[model samples]
Target: MSVPESEELCLDVSGGRSGQGPATWGQQAIWDAVSVLGDDAPRYNVSVGFELPAGRPRAAVLEALTRAARLHESLRTRLLPDGAGGLTQVLDAAGRFPVTVRGCEREDTERAGGQLLGELAALPFDCAGQWPLRIGLVEADGLVRYYAMALSHTAADGGGLRRLARDVVMLLDGVSPERLRELFPATQPLDQAAYQHSERGRKRDAASRKYWCAKLSEGPRGLFPPRGERVRDALFPNAVLHSPALLRAVDHVAAVRGVSGSSVLLAAAARQISLLGRAPEQLLQVVVNNRFLPGMSQTITTLAQEGLFHLRTVDEDFGDLVRRVHMSALGAYRYASYDKRLLDRDIEELRGRLPDLADHSCFFNDTREPELFRPPAGDTEVPPLERAAELTTLAWPVEFPPRKNLSFAMDVVDAPGALELAMTADSALIPRQDMESFLRGIEDAVVGDALATGCV
Candidate 1:
């Protein structure tokens, strides 16, 4: 199967209504993150911020924050809205204040984070459920040290967050981003909300409901074990090894084979499941994202259309598998355009997108957050990772409830091309050692690739 060139898309986003914070973190975090209004909350909410070292000047960081305030209106004014669904964004009348400050210890990250978290508790954010998401920074080394930034998932997705970091670097060097107003499409969340409330949108919503009901005709059935203890972190998926070497090799092969990242991952997953002793006829479910639709990107709104990708752990070679996965992805991408409304109208008792229930764990690869997505602009230089570590770094982990049966949260680092992939699952289903072993296999696979041929 051949993949076509990607076309830029837009999404409709609304300004958002001001709302109070929730009482607890458990489900509230997910609810808030998903419902965030200023832009797309559900799809773009997860983020990671970086702290970097300064060579001679320390003021650039502060300058960058100031610039951010000036550029984005939501950062300036909080939110207020009419009793109806419409929203009003208020930029703080007082000149935009720089939110960054230097601290002496590693705990500075915690200090800043606590303050912001407190703000989320008290203030009403534009979107409901999404509280303040931020990271703290501290300069322990004193002389020309590094700092970091943590933003909430609601404001931007990993890609948007990285873009903002590049902007900061540019400001330090006296550069500004290309005005986005020109390239940006007109599909704001506000437009989507208006459409969502319309008679047409209502009809669409109803059709979508019927489509889901028909799609999922059977009761729930999965092989996952139940949780007995109060889990501290998120889900714990069973050991599933995606060899780094195999991953690399597949990519190398794809360059010569002319396929995509999704093709390689899917093919590999199908093989892995088969290797795990699943019968060839067994059904395996996969999650597919629909971000490439017309007017999906840039709209601060959740625009993903979820669809299940069913595969079998049957007889197939790696190349054949890659081709199959590519074809499946393209098919799903096209099929998602109708929304649930059309499905209901066309088919009876069709199933809606749900978690993996076919005795198989989900394999989702959203590499959008990787450094490759956002190029270095405005002559901004990203400080070395080593420099960042020299400074104090605090990771106040945000525990967003598990949405799928098991999730793979792929977060991108601020650096040009790095990614952090996190897989969460129910603890009862997988133990820590098992998880470690699975990772070890991937490491081995990556190492194996390097040994066979000088390839990273």
Candidate 2:
């Protein structure tokens, strides 16, 4: 897994200025997680590759990256640890952005390139020591064939990474930063930090605490039995259920029920957990992206927060529970954004009052289509040469980090022509066979709902 010294090129980014600010709430949550995990945790490293069209020059690739580093403050912001146990984001405007140009042998370029991406994906971030962005260029025959960038999640979320890629391509096409700033004005991460400390933000935090306190008061402690030991891994081993039929069924059911696809999917998953785990009540930690707020949609930072969703005392009938799950999911999304540190404190008090609250570690996240994948606005002036070249992101496989006290986590994303559900769980608690059966039950429940609702 070692990269050879001879095949690498390093360049120090120059002419950038420097500034300082506090980390945003989203950044703080990521910082805290990384601090706990230390340097070995790759839980937050996001790596995305772009296939270089044949006509594009290698110089444009490098220039675009350097420009990106200079233009995007989040990529250059470094977290400095305080003696009193806090983190401050230091933005090096003129700091050198490192670009690693790795040349692959012509014969082994394709295979080695894939391996290289996975290796980069597994590398941890040093938030307190260096810039949060790492760029890797794959070269063959003196031309840049493919390029990949790995970013710390503290600076960007899944959506932000995609946006970053789009901007890079736009820059490669010779779009001026002024034009970009006008067309897609980004809300700087620092601004978000300021808002998190504002009086309004404090009020929002209080509202979140009240919502969660009441939500946890009625739920059973947890969905899974006590394992008695905390797992040190950032994520557990998991399996995926990808089905075009399932996706169609979910959409059909949602249409008939006048609900979102996410609601239908959530209902199906909760139903499966109730049947398989034999827990009449299920507590799900649902992840929601808080970018829907004004002036924050284009912000390139981590804005994802978790909201607790409790499915309790449901009647055995599956159809009735779907309505309940949908309503609960709506309520959960409403209270998803909040100060994590404050929310954590409230959770502790709630757990004390309701001891079973300790067992509610299961999570669900429905990542709908990312807006970053959309085509850049056509109205913006751009060169025909850059327009001729097709640019898109390449997906890379990344391992999930282990979760402490997490029995299972279910993630659903909309694939091209299907819905994909990836469930990661602790094998010691929910065995492989049982989880597989749970997946089957989800499909069955979804299909049954679609049929019963006249969606067949």
Q: Against the unseen true structure, what C-alpha lDDT does each candidate score? A: 0.40, 0.72
Q: Ten-residue segment with the worst summed lDDT in candidate 1?
A: 20-29
Mind giving the per-residue lDDT tens digits that candidate 1 earns over 215-284? 3433224433442464565543433332223333444545644677555555554454344333343233
- The number of residue pairs in model 1 that clash at the backbone is 44
lDDT of 1: 0.40
TM-score of each: 0.56, 0.82
Please tell me which predicted candidate would have the highest lDDT against the true structure. 2
lDDT of 2 by residue, 1-456 (tens): 566443445556665567677778888888888777776668668777755656356778878878877667788788887777567888775555456666766665565566667666788877888878777777777777777888888988877787788788899889977788888787777777778779987788788778888767766765665433545554456778765556567767777777777777788788777766678787788887777777777667788888888777665776677677888887877788787877888888777876665356788887764334522333534322222112212221344566676778888866654566788887667776777777767777777676666653
Q: What is the lDDT of candidate 2?
A: 0.72
Residue-level lDDT for 116 in candidate 1: 35
